[model samples]
Target: MTTITTSAPAIGPLSTSTIAPANPRAPSRKSGIAAASLIRLSGLFAVAAGLVYAGIQPIHPADVLASVTTQSWAVIISLKLAMCLAFLVGIAGIYARQAGRAGWLGLAGFVVFGLSWFLQSGFVFTELFILPPLASIAPQFVDGFLGIVNGHPTELTTGPMAAAYSVVGLLYLVGGILMGVSTVRAGVLPRAPSVLLALAALVTPAAAMLPHALQRFAAVPVGVAFVWLGIALLLELGRSRA
Candidate 1:
């Protein structure tokens, strides 16, 4: 007869619980890299949005009700819808990148600007979908809406749209100035673009008063600033990785 003793294996041989060791840092590391990549991608989106914005302005038609049915109007407004969506994403990345240094002003500007984009998004959607069908169904109403947009007089009654338009413009003006000034104070992005952002916001009302042909040019400065900031962000990201 022989006495036999059995105990658990030293390495806990091939059981479910002991097969592998958990890595505490791997998940965090992966998440961090993923976030950084998202930021980088947003920089690219910003550049694309800037280009689209500038490109569309040249072709953007007047706010006449007749333009609503035309192919050109549809195309231009479709582009605008895209621009608003992309800009919203890009701006979030922009703010996140500099948040630490951006301080209270940056926070305020980001919130305000973000809100403006949200409003713009809703308006663009209405323009893209509702306005087209409504153009034929309710011509006068559409005309009045366009009037609210262009500051023209219309016989038709359009409630609250004028006020909404003014609110959107005001938010944009204030937000851009705050963001620009904060960027300048933070000294994170290029100075020229930051300064241009502020200047463009300031001149918007004057530009809006210009004839349609000339009004489009007002977008140039803002577009240029967007492009420059996007480029700067990409460059900064690249340097960090290196």
Candidate 2:
């Protein structure tokens, strides 16, 4: 009998084919979770910004020119800061979440909505830096400017200023409506809040047409929607972490 030294054939290193392939989606999933977390964080700013904006009622142009008190300035400045920051961080996350899912609508929403925010910041900048000083020196001029701000362009409003106001309003109104619709279609967020987002956007400009007392509160729907979306994102984030 052969020394029957049938030594066991040595096991070769496992072939690459036999090895389990790493999950391709794991990285993407992780990234999505991270993005969601970031979106949640930004939602805080959005919620605060919406609330502040909703609460604000631009002082009568006359009042602004007459006194420009410290408290009033502080409030206006705070609202501007919050509004700018909210859109900055909020839109980044909105784009991240919706871009992949909402297609062209998402793109449109992101562009117009983001532009609205940018335009708003520019307007705020003018208010903060230019108007205040001007108010002291040329109350009459500011009064004319305020007319534009109030969506009532007067003869005093230069063509450029009137154009700016129109652009801002159009962007905000149209962008908001498109974004809201896209958000609803994205289906990643809660449906109710998403609908509210759209409703708020649609109603906000219309709300402006309401009586003076109702005008300031026109922003409340949007604010509430932001708060809802923020809370939803945060909740989803917690689940993802778990």
What lDDT does the true structure give each of the candidates? 0.84, 0.72
List model 1 lDDT by residue over 128-197, tens digit each.
Answer: 8888899888988888877777677476645577777788989989998998899998888888998998
Candidate 1: stretches off by over 4 Å: 1-27, 153-158
Q: What 10-residue stretch in candidate 2 is worst by lDDT? A: 60-69
Q: How far off is residue 165 in model 2, in Å?
A: 1.0
lDDT by residue for model 2 over 120-177, one digit each (tens)? 8876777767777787677778777766765555677769988987788788788878
At residue 173, give the lDDT of candidate 1: 91
* Global Cα lDDT for candidate 2: 0.72
Error of 2 at 148 (Å): 0.9
Model 1 Cα displacement at 174 (Å)? 0.5
Clashing pairs in 2: none
TM-scores, in order shown? 0.86, 0.79
